[model samples]
Target: MASMKFACIVIMCFAVVGAPIAQAISCGQVGNNLKPCLRYIMSFWGSVPGLCCDGVKTVMAHVQNTADKRATCNCLKSMVAKIGFVPWRAKSIPRECGVVLPYEISTSINCDKLEL
Candidate 1:
């Protein structure tokens, strides 16, 4: 019984500590990765720059799970809204990078509607 209780405590501790780190990994670092894509996302360019595509690919690669993906998507949407990035242009970034995201990238996207 004592061993079982100790194991449960350890599990709980890991759960508590892991969630924030996981969210940070998905949401927090997105802006820095996306910085390279700013100009491409903001205005008409002949084509997305190599650095922008690389950043898009890197951002997509970080989403390891449904929750993380949703969080990352929401973070991207919010950031786009704040930065005045064109929705269609922002939507094209992942595709331009050959990264297929599960949902459309739009400021109006509802994160809860995303499929896991």
Candidate 2:
């Protein structure tokens, strides 16, 4: 009975501890991380800010799976559409920041089809 109780406690601990890891990346997180890059993304010609690169790297680091990538992509697309940024400037952000993204950053990108 003691062993069974311990096992139950272990299981409950895993359920509680692992829940956040299994949860999908939220748009709020995506927005917060990418917010610093807006100025660079909007400008026609200028150096990418260090803060912007840091933000990009931070967001990319959080993408643990395809679902997270898709969620981030969708969030980015929605943000771009609403804010109206230069497409090429936005697409170049990852490269300028020394981060290689699997998908291009564009509003037309189909987030549902994103893969790891």
Candidate 3:
């Protein structure tokens, strides 16, 4: 029983700690708007592509919780500015799943990783 209580406390602490970090990640792109990876890809190479931001928007449109939804929106928007594209394929990333990609896009995007 004592160990269970300690574990519960630890879990609660982690949850509290994580909430702000998630907020911080989403804060950077607040209101910047997302760019479609398709258009962004073309734009990088050069073209007046129509709104490609839709792809990411559609991917995340269902996120509930007004604040978290906004934060996640920011995260998606950030993806566009940083890489000029969205590479995640999926919009909202869960804590458990890994992002899979065929290419090594380290320098292309997130060359400067914020200290996590």
Candidate 4:
């Protein structure tokens, strides 16, 4: 009985961990999805238009341990960047990703500013 229960637990764990990570559509209704993040960066960097999409993408890409987590985080972060005419609050984006958002930041998700 114990062995059977253990097998069931393992199966459940696999099913939970094996779920596919959903992808996000880039600012479907907005222009140049990077604009918002860039805009936010601009305000901080003396209104300079160059904000660094590559840096943002890299930070977002490493936000997770798995491919799914990376993809999902990337999408959510991108959305926030685009929407943030000003900087965004860290608490907002995590809700979209269904994550608790540890205080530690990853490579691409440098949205520490509460500018929004």
Runs in model 3 lying further than 4 Å from the true structure: 1-36, 40-54, 85-116
- Local distance difference test, each candidate: 0.79, 0.86, 0.41, 0.45
Residue 9's lDDT in candidate 4: 100
lDDT of 1: 0.79
Q: What are the C-alpha RMSDs, in order, of all predicted structures?
A: 6.0, 3.7, 13.5, 12.6
Top candidate (TM-score): 2
Model 1 Cα lDDT, one tens digit per residue, 17-62: 8856433355657888778888877887667788878877778777
* Candidates ranked by lDDT: 2, 1, 4, 3
lDDT of 3 at 22: 31
Question: Can you list the residue pairs that collide in candidate 4?
Answer: 37-81, 59-107, 59-108, 60-108, 87-116
Clashes of 2: 0
Question: Which 10 consecutive residues of model 2 have the lowest summed lDDT?
Answer: 17-26
True-vs-predicted CA distance for residue 88, candidate 2, Å = 0.9
Candidate 4 stretches greater than 4 Å from native: 1-65, 85-88, 92-99, 102-116
Distance from true location, Cα of 8 in model 4, Å: 22
lDDT of 3: 0.41
